[model samples]
Structure formats: structure tokens, C-alpha cells
Target chain A: MDYQRKYEKSENKNIKKISIIKYIICVIIIPTVIFIGTKLFDGKKYAFLTAVVVLLSCVPFIISFEKGKNSTEKMVILAVMIALSVFGRYCFSMIPHFKPITAITVITGIYMGGEMGFLCGALAAVLSNFIFGQGPWTPFQMLAWGMTGLIAGLLSRYLKKYMVALAAYGAVSGIIYSMIMDIWSAMWQDGVFNIKRYVACIISGIPTTATYIVSNIIFLLILARPVGRKLERVKLKADIIEKD
Target chain B: MNDKMKIFNTYHPLGLFIYFASAIVITMFMINPVMLTIAIISGIAFVLTLTDIRTFLKNLAYEIPFFILIALTNPLFSHNGVTPLFFLNGNAVTLEAVLYGLDMGIMILGVIYWCKCYSIIVDSEKFIYLFGKAIPKLSLVLSMALKFVPVFKRQYRKISDAQKCFGYYATDSYFDKIRNALRVFSCLITWSLESSIDTSVAMKAKGYGLKGRTHFHNFRFHIRDLFLIAVTLFMDIVVFTGIGTDIIDFRFYPKITQINLNAESIAVYGAFIILMFMPAFLEIKEKIKWKYYVERI
Candidate 1:
């Protein structure tokens, strides 16, 4: 048992080192490359920007999965949650622009950890688009949802305890999703950043944005406690990570 | 195995992916009226050839109004052109803006159609096959997520049916319905989460995530795939050059530019048309060949 404890301690140390390296890569190296590439490659900046965003988005999952003690179990849980989120979107297809995907993603993050949340959010976007149809807007959707999950996971301690905070986060996520998408629209419209056009795009998207916010609030308020409780239970049962 | 040899299905997944990606990138970037028209027509033809008549017509019915909405909305926001068609809220609805809006609408529809075709062609299997080697864990998670969608849906249906049998109908009061729905959802969460433990255990037992693991792959890069890739690359290069050199450029803002129908522009248009219509043309050729051979037999 003492030897087992020593082995586990070494494994934890390794995970910590790997995570630190991943953070540096995700936060520093990727953005620097994108900035430099944009400056250096005048003709292909858009492609370069997209490639960077896509690559950065995967870092969380890669780091988290590698760091976790029971990586397979953690992956399975994340995969299941993402599937649930995607299915939730389909379930709400009768209502226009009303989906529980964001809420589920946030909940996944709050319970599973931020990295898992991001994975759930990003994968949910890509997978749901398989049904809804893919477009230039897909990457934006992925970013928006992935960030939502990541933030929720980061703030899970405060959020898991307070229903109001969870609801607020959901509303904010909805706005973020709409705003980012509007940026995409404006860019697509003019092929350059025009402030007037972007503002117009934002103004035009208000109604849908409002719906998204309300639906997010409703879904989060409804799903957070029950879902969070169940997920926590699963994490414990599966021994996904060592106890703090 | 015999199904793999069909023209539309024959190319290596990577080859097909490159073709679709290049096509989409070109279609989205180049907003030339001629190019947009070719894209829309070819997109429609491809959709029709690939899907049944009923599905094709259904898609068109959905697409046409969406097209109109996008085209009509653009003129409202953008008042760039010189020729004023009408005044809306004291803003001049310029002819250029309307025409540009129409072009944008067509481009949007064309991209959507192409994306639909892409989804049909690149099933989850193909997607996993392409990305699995580089990111095995991610591909595994993605495949599991996809598989879980239907599984969870089925479980939800079963749970709801069971609840209904116990007189928990959603037709009750709004609050009651919401509560009951939440109850059903929570139950699904518990059930699925519990089952995933079993799944992970089974996977671990099967030696998943271990070193020296080998996987079965059905995809093979044939000579035809190489030819397809070469042709697609050639077309993309020609189109990109034309765009880069401003030979096939069109401007809508400030004023609409006159389209040059010169030899270079025509070549650009021809290359785009060929690229866009390649799938539809191949599918038709295969259909004709099958018909002729059957008649001879």
C-alpha cells in the first residue's frame, strides 16, 4: 500500500508537469504563432487564424485526458455528456433557436472539470452541426460553446453552490454565442472589419439573442442541480480523479 | 466491399475531404456573380443527383425562402451602390446593395447545399478514419459521443413512456410539466452515467489506450483517388490564381464593378464550373454506364 501511494504521487507529479506545459502551449505559443502568421502571411491570414483557433480548442481535452488518473473513464463520461447535449439540442428543435446544449455543456464543466467541459462544448457544436448542416459559422459556434464550458468548469466551485450564478453564466454564454456569431456575419458580409456593419449585425441579432439567453437561463436553472449531483456521483463511483 | 467501388464513394476519404474543403473555401471566399451562379447551380444539381427527388424538392423549398430572406435583408443594412431602387426609412436601397444581397443569398444557399452533401458523404466513420490516427483519444470520444446520441434518445423515450404510463403527462400544468420533464431528464442522466462505467471497464479490458494497439482500417488510397486529388488541386490553383491576380474580381461596395468577360475571366469561370460540377458529372456518368450495361445484359 505504501508503494502504491508512492506510485500515485509520482503519477500526480507527472500530470502537474504535463498540465503546466499544455497551459504554456495553449496560452502563449499558439497565440504568438497566430499573431506572427497573420503579420507574415498577408494573403492567407483567415486560414491561418482558423487553423490556430481549431488547434487551441483541442488543447484542453488533450491535457485533461492525459492528466486524469482514469483517462478512459473520464473520456467516456465526457463523451456521454456531449452526446446528451447534442441530443438535447435535437429534443428542442421544435422551438426555434432554443437549445439546452449550452446548459448541458456548462453543467458538464461544472461537474467534470473545465477541460472536460470545453471538450463537451466543442464536440457538441461540431456533432450537432452534422445534423443542422456545417458552415463558416461552425468554428465560431465551437469557440463560443467551448469557452462557455471552459469558464463554467473554472468557476465550478462558486457556480455549483449557487443556482443564481449558474443561471447568470448561462445567460452570459448565450450572449457570447450570439455576439461571436454576429462578428462572423459582419466579417462575411464585408470581408473586412467594418464597425458600422458589425453594430448593425449585433442589433439585428437581438431577438434571437434574447431567446437564447432566456432558454439558457431556464435550462441551467432546471438542469444544474440534478445533473450536477448525478455527475458528481458518477465521478466518485468511477474514481475518475484522486480526491483533493 | 462492392459498395466502395462506386464513383461517388470510391475516392479515399482524405481525397473526398480535400475536394469538399477546397470547394467550400473557394465558394465562400470568391463572391463573383458568375462563380456564385455556377456554385448554386452545381450545388443544386449535386443535391438532386445524390438525394431522392422528394428530398431534393424539400431542401429547395426550405432553401428558397432562406435565400430570399438573406438577399432581401442585405439590401436593408447595406446602402453601398450608386443606383437607388427605393428608399427605406430614408436610406437609399441601392441597386448594387440588392444585387450584392442576391449574390450573398446564392452563395449562402450554395454553401449550405455543399455542406449537406459533405455531411452525407463524410459519415462519422469517415471522419474518425481520417482523424483517428493523429488523435486517437479524441476520435474515440467523438465516436462514443455519436453512438451515445441514439442510445440516450432511446433511453429518454423509454423513460418518458414509463412516466406516461404512471400518469405523468406533459399536458399537465406548465410548472408540473417542466418539473416532470426535469425529473425525466435527471433519471436519464443517472442511468447513462452509471452505464458508462461499465463501458469504460469493458473498453479497458479490451486493451484500449495500451501501447502497441492495432486498429482495422478499410480505407485505401487508390490511383483514382490520386487522380481526383490532382484534378481538385489543379482547379483550386487556377481559381486561387485568378482571384489573387484580380482577374476574376467583383466589387459591390462604393459601386458595382463591371465583370470582364475576357479570356482569363472565362477560364476562371470554366475551371470553377468544372470543379463545382465534378461530383454531379461523375454520378451521372456512373448512372448512365450502369443503365447501358444492364440493357446489354
Candidate 2:
């Protein structure tokens, strides 16, 4: 058991080291690729290339799951979380622009760690779109939701402790989602990015954004305690802990 | 399944995936109005061949309003172009902007139709097959999630029904209804969490993620799949090189350029149309052959 603990400690250190590289790729490499690719390639090639890059960025998170103990259990928990999030979206389908996907994603991050949260969030977007119909916006949706989960997971320490902070994070996530999607809309509108058009897109999307914010806050307030507690119990039962 | 063998249906999953991926990428990148028109028409034809007239019309019905909204909104926000059509709030609405917007709208509509067609062709099994080799863990989780969605939905309904029998959800007020829904959702989370523990234990008992774990594959790449792949790659090369070399140049902003019609450009267009409607053409050919065979009999 002592040797097992020492091995896990080393693995945690290695993960920490590798995660910095992942951050650099996600933050620096991806944008640079997009910027350079757009400048060099035509709209079609650029769009395809960007989608591939975004999908590739998810590899680190997927790989990170293997470094932990009880990988199968972690995977099962993630699948269940993704399924529940998708089901949450369906439950609120009657309400226009109101969804619990973001709130659920944020809570998942807060409990299961960020990498699992990111996976769940990203999977929910694609899986839900299987029923909602997919388009060019699918990649953008994945990135947005994935980032939401990542951010929530990164801030899980604080978010788990405070109810108010979690709700605030939920509202911010809604805005971020709208903003990312608006960028896609603007890019789709004109082959090039036009500021005036992007601004107009945001303005037109204000109502939907408002609904997102409201639904996120409402859902987070309602779900964080119950769902978060249940997730905590699962984590305890599985004996999975976030390796420092 | 063996009763009617169409080319697309007979091809390897990889070949089918390549066709749709290349088609969608090329369609989205194309800015030339002429190319877009060809794509839209082929998209419609593909939809018709794949499904039925009802589904084709339904897709178009869903797309038209979105098309109009995008086209109309472009003229409102984008005031770029040479030919001014009118002035709204001191902004010049140009014919070019409207036309540009119309092109974008058509592109989006075409892409959406193509994606819908793609979904019909590529089921979750095919998707898992394509990615499963590279990311075994992720694929397993994805397939599991796919399985769980229907299960969760049924569970939700059952739980809701059980609750309703106990008068737990009998509230008439909107707020009360929302509260009751939240209660049902909370219950679901608890149930799923408990159930997941059982699933994980079962999976572990099966020695999942063990070393040298072998996966079962039903798909095999035959000689015909090779031919299909070669043909698609050739078409993709032709189209991409044509676009790369400016042989199929098109600009939508400032002013719409007249499409240059030459042998190479026409060839590119033909290649694109064929590639875009490859599956549809195969299905049509099969239908014709079946009719002829029936008549001879």
C-alpha cells in the first residue's frame, strides 16, 4: 500500500507536468493553428482543419482518464453524467432556449474533476445534436461546452465550497456559450470576421442569451446541492479522488 | 439486408465516411454561387433518393425560413458592396450584400441538408467503428452513453408516471410544475448514480480494459471498397487542385464575379456534383437495374 501510494504520487506529478503542455496546446497552439490556417487556406479547408484541430485538442483530456485508478469506473460515471445532461436538455425542450446542460456540466466538473467534466460536457453537445440535428456549429458547441466544463473543474475547489459562486459561474458559462456561438455565426455569415456583423449577431441573440442566463442560474440553484451530493457519494463509493 | 445491394451500402464504412467528409468540407468551402447551386441541387436530389419526397420536402420546409432569415439579416447588418439598393438608418443596403447573404444562406442550407443525409448514412455503430481503434476508452464511454440515453428517457417517464400516480405532480400552477419536474430530475440523478456503481462492478468482472483486450468488428474492407475509395480520392484531388490553383475562383463580396467557364472548371464542377451525389446516383442505378430485371423476368 505504501508503494502504491508512492506510485500514485509520482503519477500525479507527471500528470501535473503534462497538463501544462496540454494547456499550452489548448490556449496557444490551437488559436495559432486557426489563425495561420485561415490565412493560408480557403474557407472550406480552413473550416475542416479547424474542426479537426478542435477535436484533436480533446485527446489530452481523454488520455488523462487512463492515468487514474479505477478508469473503468470513471468512464462509467462520465457516461452516466453525459446521458443525464442530454436528458436534462430534453426535459426542458418545451422551454425555449432554456437548458440544464451547462449547469449540469458545471456541477459535474465541481465533483468529478475537470477532465471528466470536460468529457461529459463535450459528449453531451454531440450526443444531443444527434437528435437536434448537426451543422457546422457542432464543433463550436463542443468547444464552448468543453471549455465550460474545464473552467468549472479548474475552479472546483472554490465552486464546491460556495453555492453563490457556482451560480455565478453558471451565468458566466451561459454568456461564454452564447459568445462562442456568436463568433461561429459571424464567421458563417461572412467568410471573414466582420466586427459590425458580429456585434449585430450578439444584439440579436440577446433574448436567447437572457434565457440561457436565467435557466442556468435557476437550474444551478436547484440542482447543485442534490446532484453534487449524489456525485460526491458516487466518488466516495468508487474511492476516486482528485490527485493533487 | 442483402436483398438490395447499392454501391454506398456495399462500400466499407471508411469509404462511406470519406465520401461524406470530403463532400461536406468541399461544399462548406465553396463560395462560388454556381458551385453552391450545384451542391444545393445535388443535396436535394440526394435527400430525395435517400428518403422520400415527404422527408425531402419537410427538410426544405424547415430550411427555407432559416435561409430567408439569414439572407434578409445580412442586408440589414452588412452594408458592404458597390451597388447600393436602398438606405436604412443611414446605412446603404447593397444588391451585392443581399446576394452575398443569399449565397451564405444557400451554403448553410446545403450543408445542413448534407449533414442530415450524413446522419442517415452514418449510424452510431459506424461512428464508433471509425474512432474506436484510436481511442478505445473514449469510444467505449461514447457507446455506453449512447445506450444510456434511451434507458434514461424511459426511466424518466416511468418515474414521472409513478410520481403522478401518487399525486406528486398534480400541481396546476406553472411554478409548481417546474418544482415537480425538478424533483423528478433529482430522483433520476440519485437512481442513475446508484445504477452506475452496479454497471462499473459488472464491467470490472468482465475484465474490461485488461491487457490484450480484443474488440469484435463486423466490417471488412473488400476489393470493391478499395475501388470506391480510389474513385472518391481521385474526385477529391481534382476538385481540391482546381480550387487551389484558382481554376474555380469565386468572390462574393464587393461585387459578384462572373463564373469563368472553362474545361477545367467545368470538370471540377462535374466532379463535385458527382461526388456530392455519389450515393444517390448509386441508389438510382440500383433502382433502374432492379426494374429492368423485373421486366425481363
Candidate 3:
């Protein structure tokens, strides 16, 4: 029994070490390499490189989620959350650029673990875009929303304590999403990255960005309390996710 | 209903997936006039064949303003190139910028059309099959979420109706209506998350995530798929080599240089045209085969 316990302890340490390495490579190394590649490479390659780098940044979170020994209930709950966001999109379709998706994603991240939060936000992009339309911008949307959820989950403890911080984070994420998408527009326009054109795109996109910020803040303030409580209740009742 | 799908979609999912991925990516990289024209033309042709004429025209009509917006916006912001077309708000709207803007717009159009074709060809089922073997868990999550979208939407309607019956939405005040709408939303989260336990149990009972899990899918990798993939990859390599080697140059900055096509560029250009029109070639061949059989009949 002692031997088995020691073996398990070493194996757990190894797993933790591997995950840290994965994060370093995925989050830090790959992006740095892509940044260098973008500089060295000629005009249009950066467009493809950006797409690849953003997609690769998303892979670690997804791979870790898949690798974890998770329950089916978590998957089902994630499905439900994603569905709720998509339904939210339908509810507010009349309004342009204003969506409750970011707020809902953050709330889920607060309740669920970071990985499930990332999955919810990312899958919500894919699932909803399947109905709307998939474009070159889809990958960027996934990255933006996924990071929102991942960061929200990481900062859940702090955000859950203060509603103002949660709303602030939502507003910031909206800006990030809008900026990331603007990078795509600039790249698309110039076929090369031009600072002047990118700035123009940002300026043109201000109205949309403002709408995103306003909608995210409103939705976060309203939905956080009810959704977070419900998630806590649901997670607690799910048995496998119950904390001591 | 039977003819709702196109000939391109009948191939294995892997081939179709690779085709669209490479096609879309390469089209985005291309700024050469010849290549972009081929891409845009074939894209329109593919979309036309994908859907009916009226729908295609309607989509194109809707896209024109956006296309023009993308085109004209470049001159406003970008004052590149030597030849000044006009002065707009003290910014010299150069010919290069206008042309570059139009190029960007065409490139964007090609991508959008390809995406439209991709959405038509690659349904959720095919998406599940494509990723299911490689990334089972994520695919399962995607599948589950896709399935739940409609179910949740239905339940939302049901709950909203019940609330309406209770005179929840009868209030004239906008704030009250908003509050009541949120309550319905809260009620949705509760009911769905609570029932997810049973859903998960039912799935667990069916051996989900178990070892030796058999996945049922309609796609089968055939020799034709192998041929399609090989051709697609081969063309993509040629296009990449041409682009990487800086052979097919079409620059629209400072001075719009008249492109002098070398032997390599011509070869690459021919390859891209063939690459873009493969679906058209296949559809025509199918039509010819049907004609021959019908005549014999």
C-alpha cells in the first residue's frame, strides 16, 4: 500500500509537470515564435500565421479539457450553457453587435472550472456561428470568447466577491474581442499589416465596440447573480463536481 | 430533398474539409489579379451551383454595399501609391489605395463565398465525423451542444408562453418587461441544468466515453477521396511554392508595377485556376455522364 501511494504521488507530480510544460509552450513559446515568424516572413504570410497562432493558442485549453477525467454531467451542463447563450443570441437578434454571450460565458466560468468555461465560450462561438455564418473571423471569435471565459474562471474567486469587477472584466473582454477582430479586418484590407489602416478600422469599429461594452456590462450585472447562483447549485447537486 | 446536396459534398468528409481549408486559406493569401479573378469567378460559380439563382443573387446584392464599403474605406484611411486619384478631406486618395481596396474587397468576397460553400457542404454531422476520430471529447461536446440548441430554444418558448399566460409580459413598462424576460431566462437555466443529470446518466448508460466505443458515421474513405485529397494537396503545394518563392508578384503599393509573368508564375497560375475550378470540372463531368446515359435510355 505504501509502494502504491508513492508511485501515485510521483505520477501525479509528473502529470503536473507535463501540464505546466504544455501551458508554457502553448501560451508563451508558440506566440513568440509566431510573432518572430510574422516579422521575418513577407507580406501575406502573416494573415495565415495569425490564424494558425490564434487557433494553436486555443488548443491547450481544449486538449487539457479532453485529457481530464471528467464526468458526463459536466459535458451536459456545458452543452446547456452554450445552448442558453445561443438562445440568448436569438432573443437579441434584432439588436446589432450587442450580445449577452460574453456575460453568460463569464458567469459559467465563475461556476464551472476554467477548462469547462473555456469550452463553453469556445463552443458557443462555433455552435452559434453554425447558424449565423462561419467566416475567416470565426477562429478569432473563438479565441476571443474562449480567453474571456478562461480568464474569468481564473479570476472567478475575486470577481464572484465583487460585482463591479465582473462587469469591468466583461467590458474589457468586449474591447479585446473587438480589437482582435479589427486586426482581421486590417489584415484583410491591406493584404499586409499596416498600422494606419488598422487604426482606421478601429476608429470605424468604435460604435460596434461601444455597443459590445454596453451590452456586456448590462448582461453581466443582471445575469451574474442569478446565473452564478444557479451554476453553484447545479454544480453542487451534480455530485461529481461537489467540493468539500 | 435528395438533390439538396451537391456532388462535391458526396465525397468523404476529410477530402471536402481539406479542399475548403486549403482553398479558403490560399485565396486569402492571393493578391495577384489573375489568381483572384479565378478565385472570385469560380467561387461565384460554385455558390451558384450550390444554391438557386434567386438566393445567390439576393446574397450577392446584399454583399455589394459591404463590398463597396470595404473598397471605398481603404482610400479614406490608406494614402499609399504614387498616382493621386482625388483629395478626400485633405487625404490624397491614391489610385493604388483604391485598387488595393478593391483587391481586398474581392479577396474578402472569395473567402465569404468559399465559406458559404463550406457551410453548405460541411454540415454538423460531417463536422462531428471529421473531428470525432481525432478529438472525441471536443466533438462530443460540440455534438451535444448542437443538439441542445434547438431543445433549449423550444423550452425557452414553452417557458415564455407559460410566463405570458401568467400575465408576466402584460406590463406596459419596458423595465418590467425586461425584468420578467430575465426571470424566464433564469427559470430556463434552472430547469435545464437540473435535468442535465438525467441526460448525463442516460448517456453514461449508453456507454459514452467508454473504452472500445463504437462510433457510427456515414463517411467512408474511398480511393476517390484519396485522389481528391492528393490533387488538392498537390495544388496547394504548388500555390504555396509559387507564393513563397515570390514568383507571382502583384504589388499595389507606392507604384503599381505591371506584373511580368515568368514561366514559373504562369505554371502556378494555371495550377491555381485548375485548383479553383475542380468542383466545376466534376459537376460538368457528372452532367456529361448523365447526358450519355439518358441518350442511351
Q: Clashing residue pairs, candidate 2? A: A44-B29
| Residues A14-106, model 3: lDDT tens digits | 668659868897779897877787665655547767777777777777766666556898888888888888888877765787678888888
- lDDT tens digits, residue span B1-297, model 3: 233446787899889999999999888887788889899999998887777889888887889999999888888877878999778788898999899889888988998999998888888888889888767888887888888878878898899889989877677786776677678878988888888888998998998876786878777889999999999999999999998778887788889978747789899989998899999788767768878999999
Candidate 2 local distance difference test against the native: 0.82
Tell how far residue B260 is off in model 3, in angstroms.
3.6
Tens digits of per-residue lDDT for model 2 on B186-261? 9988998899989999999999977888889788999978887888899999999998899999875677788989
Top-lDDT candidate index:
3
**Docking class for candidate 3:** medium
Instruction: Point out where model 1 deviates above 4 Å.
Output: A1-70, A242-244, B1-6, B85-90, B170-179
Tell me how candidate 3 scores on lDDT: 0.83
TM-score of chain A of 2: 0.83
For model 3, name the residue pairs that clash: none
Per residue, candidate 1 scores C-alpha lDDT tens digits across B21-54 of 9988788776688898899889888877777789
TM-score of each prediction: 0.88, 0.91, 0.91
